[model samples]
Target chain A: MENLKKELKEKIIEALNLEDLTPEDIKDDELLFGEGLELDSIDALELIIILDKDYGIKLDDPKKGKKIFESIETMANYINENRSK
Target chain B: MKSEITHYCQIKNGKVIFDENLLYEDKEVDFQKFIKNAYQFFELDYRKFYKMDPLCKLAVMNSSVLIANLTEKLDPKTALLLTNKSACVDIDLKHQKSITEGFARPADFVYTLPNISLGEISIKNKLRSENSFFIFETFNPEFLITYTQQLIQTKKANAVLAGWVEIAENDYNALLFLVEKKKGIALKKENLLNLI
Candidate 1:
């Protein structure tokens, strides 16, 4: 779970172009959408692709991703539970 | 009072970036290679202009290079004067294709507006100054010189990036100069040809 959290943080930084940030800067329990990283709708699209490509989870609705991707903790939990492959 | 071209650079496909003194007879650009280099150089990995809008791409390419070369930072008061011949023709074609086809990409529609390229540059650089886009069959030195001088005289801008940026279905030519009321030589609007 901790390794997944670290990997998720790196993916978020790369996919969203958080250029000023390093993977170690992101906290596992910090909010992903707003205060923690200041991500937006476009970041959400990128996260959807990360879910599909890495975890084999296809989110049909981006809104559902809000609950699934609220924080690094929430995301790792969801992916561990629902990953198809 | 008049502004001068302190520094400038222009480049065609696979050529060394140079200024106006270096004559470039070759007008051909490897569109595929140019597009690829531009994407890599600018880090614009997004799906914008993937269908090959040469004009839009030219704007992005030149602005990227220019910004990279600029020694000074741009602000809201910086005036941007963009001159182009074919303004968003590629976008127009895409819009027509969408009408004929079942689905029109909404993103293409957004780029169809005539001044979109200019707006894109301004947004990319966060420049909020007086920006203008002009269309002409060829370079009008008289108007170009006059307008640039007047903008500075009127205090609309501290610096002006003025030039002819012409692109077609597959070709592009950019003549760019950074003008400011600083430690640069001054020339009358009528003497532009001689100065160039």
Candidate 2:
């Protein structure tokens, strides 16, 4: 779980082009939207693609991304259980 | 209705020249490096700019300089009109290659359309007016003049940001103008062509 959380943080930074951020900068429970990361709708779509391409976890409905991508901890937990690749 | 060119900017030959003055000139011949240097030279903080494709990046960089000197608040009704010869064909080919290789990047995929630059500009400047992108065989000042005049005369927009932005194979050119109802050179096709 610790390794997955770290990996998820790195991937999120790379996927979103957060050049100024590092894995340590993202708190495991930090909000990914609004005040925390301030990710917008387009970033949400890109996160969906990341889930599909990197983990082979295809999310059919984009609305589900809000819950799944709430934070680094949530994403790491979901991917650990669901990642096919 | 009357309109004039308030400010303008051009990016060509690895330089960002604003209002007839050189703002940035990169020693590196690399296109990406030059863009990064220009962005840094201006001290711009818009993080989303790093994610945009080259074409959109050029548009955003050019427009940022064009509007830098304006003291007045940017009217939300300001319209943006841009023309390009290639119309994002460079990025289109790259996206196609990605698909053919069985991995499509979402970042490149989102910029396949030419008009996406206008959206980027609007989002950065907080302009909420109508915007359009036109593809042309070559730069046509007449089309820009006529369309911009119509927009202003019909009260559809209080001002218009119109010009040509083309980026292909490490070469790029952007000649943009801010036209508003102000006292300056009368908005004419000849004036627009001369500025370019």
Candidate 3:
């Protein structure tokens, strides 16, 4: 799970082109949207692409994304449980 | 009161010059690297810059500095009047391919239109005034001056950032100048032409 969280942070940074940020800069529990990373709607779509392409997790319901993408920890845990790849 | 070009910056041949003074240059002249170098040189805080496509990056690369140098505290309604030859064709090609292959990337799709470059400028400057982008076979200084004069005269804009940004075939030429009611270089066609 520790390794998975670190990988998630790197993937998020790469997928969103958060050029100035590194995995060390992002805390596992820090918010990914609104106040923390301040990611917007377009970034959300890019995150969706990351989930599909990397984790093989198809987010059919957009509403579920609100909870699943809350933080790096949540994303890593979700991938642990559901990722096909 | 008449429109005057206060501050101007040019990006061409891998060199960035403001008011005839060299500010930055890249011998490689790669579009991505040039923009990245400019952003780093300016020490920009805008994170949205990373998401923008090359056209918007080109627009912002010139604008970030000029807008920061505006010290007079002009109206928030500063307008943008821009002319471009390529008109986002660079991103449009990639977006079209993305659509054909599978899904259209939202970020790329959003920048397929040239005017979005104006949006990037607006976001950086917090401008609420009118903005326009025109496509021409060449840089149309005449059209830019005419419209800028009209906008300022009609109260549509307090000031205008008028310039040309042409990006095609991996080459780019951009010039942006802030125009106010008075001072600095006279906003004349010949003056604008001479600067180019």
Candidate 4:
């Protein structure tokens, strides 16, 4: 789980072009939108692609993504349990 | 009312010139790195810049300097007139390649339109004004002068942000100017051409 979280942070930074941030800058429980990382709907779409393409996790329902992508912790936990790859 | 070109920004090669004053220059790096440097040198607070396509990035950066130098707040009705030779072709080609390879990203799909650059500038500046983009064989300062006059005279807009931004592989030329009804260099063909 710890390794998955670290890898997720790196992927997020590269995929989102968060040029000013490093893996250390993001906390496990930090919100991905609004305040912490300030991501938006577009970024949410990009994250969905990452999950589908990289982790083999197809998120069919967009509403469930809100809870699944709440933080690095939630994403890592969800991916750990659901990722087929 | 006679519109005048108040201020202008030019980004050519790897240098940034505003109102005919050199503000930033880095001749050593490529275009992508040059934009990143320009973003930092200008001290822009907008983080969404990183997510933009290259054309939009250049447009936003060029307009931002003029916006920052405004002596007074921008009138909400200020219009935008953007003319470019190579409208978003840089991203269009990349997106085409990504699709041919079977891995097109949504981000790339969203920026396929040239007007998205104007949209990005509007969103960044928080200006809810009329905006238009035109394609031309080259920079057309004459059109800007006439259109600016029409908008100001008709009260459709108080000011106009007119620009010509062209970006291609290993080459880029961007010039953005603010036009007002009065109080700057007279918006004449000679004066506008001199900046280019």
Candidate 5:
């Protein structure tokens, strides 16, 4: 779980280009959207692509992303359970 | 038709010049690093800036400098007329490579058209009057002058953001002017040529 969270944080930073941030800067429970990281819809799309390309977790419906991408913890937990790659 | 050059921004050779004054310059940096430094210097927090290809990033950076100090809100009647030689060829080549490798990314695919930079500017500034992007073999000041004149004379726009934004290979330059019916030098082809 700890390793998955760290990798997820790194992936988010690289894929969404949180250029000024590092993995340590992102708290596991911090919100990914709105006030926390201030990510927008486009960042969400990039995260979806990251999940598919890096983890082989395909999300056909974007709405599911709201829950899975709520925070680094959520994304790491979801990917650990479902990642094909 | 009478119009004035209210404001302008020129980015070239790792330097950003606004209204003829040198704002930032760093010749040693790579293209991406230079752009990132300029964006940081401007203190711009627009997150979507990262997603833009080099051409769009250049356009947005230039326009952001041009409109930074306006006391009044931008007129919705503002039109954008931008010209470029390469016309998103840089991003197009990247997208083509992605397709050949069987891993085409949609984000890259969206910027295949050069005018998408105009869309980015309009969305950021909320200017909805008129906008067009043209491709020229070389910088053509006469056409820009003529088109800007027509837009002002026809009362189609109260202001026109017109300029040349060229990105070829690793080299890039953006020269943009805000044309309006206000106090400034007359918008002339010679003046535009001299600035570029």
Candidate 6:
């Protein structure tokens, strides 16, 4: 679970080109949207791809991502519970 | 107050890809060959444009190169006002094809928005100021001047790049001018349109 969260943090930083951030700077419980990271709808789409490709978790509707990707904590937990591959 | 043409470049087709040495006179020239020559000089680094709708590609390519050259070191509060026609018409066609083909690419859909070109230019130039794009059947020099002046006078921008950029399947034209307010050169209304 720890390793998956770390990887997820790295992927988020890379896909979004958050140039000033490092993996360690992303707190596990920090909100992934709005005030914490300020990620918007488009970034949500990238996160959806990351979930599908990295964990084999296919989210058919983008809206479903709000709960799964609420934070690094939630993402790690959801992946641990439902990742297919 | 008026601004002088301190720096200028005009590229057409592909030959003058990114040449900063292009100079235009009041006389009309073979715009097509000029564009072709401009293309030959610069190879597009962005592959996404190749896959974009053709009209979208033309608009993106033209604006991208100019913005790339003009803002190598961006001036603060620079405004942009551009005009075009049949914006992303080709993209609409491709979008329809995607629906028929059973899968639509998200990236293609993103470019289909006409305003995306303005965003792309702003991103590339690091310009954060008054910006607008218009779709018109033909060029209107008066509108371009008025809108650009408003941006400057309202403090929304310090300088403006204004022009008409039109592209169809086989036809394209770009007439651009960099405008700003400064001392020494008094900009007269009568000669404004003829400057570019």
The total number of steric clashes, by the backbone 3 Å criterion, in model 1 comes to 0
Error of 3 at B18 (Å): 1.7
* DockQ, each predicted model: 0.06, 0.45, 0.63, 0.68, 0.38, 0.04
**Tens-digit per-residue lDDT, B46-100, candidate 6:** 4233334444444555665655576445565877777877776656776678668
RMSD of model 2, in Å? Answer: 2.5
Tens digits of per-residue lDDT for model 2 on B1-196?
3688877889988888877888888777776678888888897888788888889989999999778856777678999999999998877998899799877777788999999999999989988898999999888999998999899999999999999999887878899988899876777888878877
**Per-residue lDDT for B189 in model 4?**
83
- Lowest lDDT 10-residue stretch of candidate 3 chain A: A8-17
Which candidate do you rate higher for DockQ, 2 or 4?
4
- How many angstroms is residue B132 displaced in model 1 relative to the true structure, after the best TM-score fit? 1.0
TM-score of each: 0.62, 0.87, 0.93, 0.95, 0.92, 0.56
Record all residue pairs in model 4 with backbone atoms less than 3 Å apart, i.e. clashing: none
Better of 3 and 6 by lDDT: 3
Off by over 4 Å in 1: A1-85, B13-28, B41-52, B185-196
Give one digit per residue, the lDDT tens place, for model 4 in B19-100.
8889888984578888988898889978889888889998999999878877888778899999988889988998899789
Backbone clash pairs for candidate 3 read none
Per-candidate RMSD, Å = 7.4, 2.5, 1.8, 1.4, 2.0, 9.2
DockQ of 6: 0.04
Candidate structures ordered by DockQ, highest first? 4, 3, 2, 5, 1, 6
Q: Judge candidate 6 at residue A33 and give its lDDT.
A: 90
Cα lDDT tens digits, model 4, A1-85, are 8999999999999888898789999999999987989998878988998898889999999899999999999999999999999
What TM-score results for chain B in every one of the models? 0.80, 0.95, 0.94, 0.96, 0.96, 0.71
Residue-by-residue lDDT tens digits, candidate 1, B1-196: 4467665545454332534444223333676456565566556654343433566566666666666666777545778787877777876896789668754544456668657777767777788888888988766777777888888888998888777676665566665667776665454455344433
Sorted into a CAPRI-style docking class, model 1 comes out as incorrect
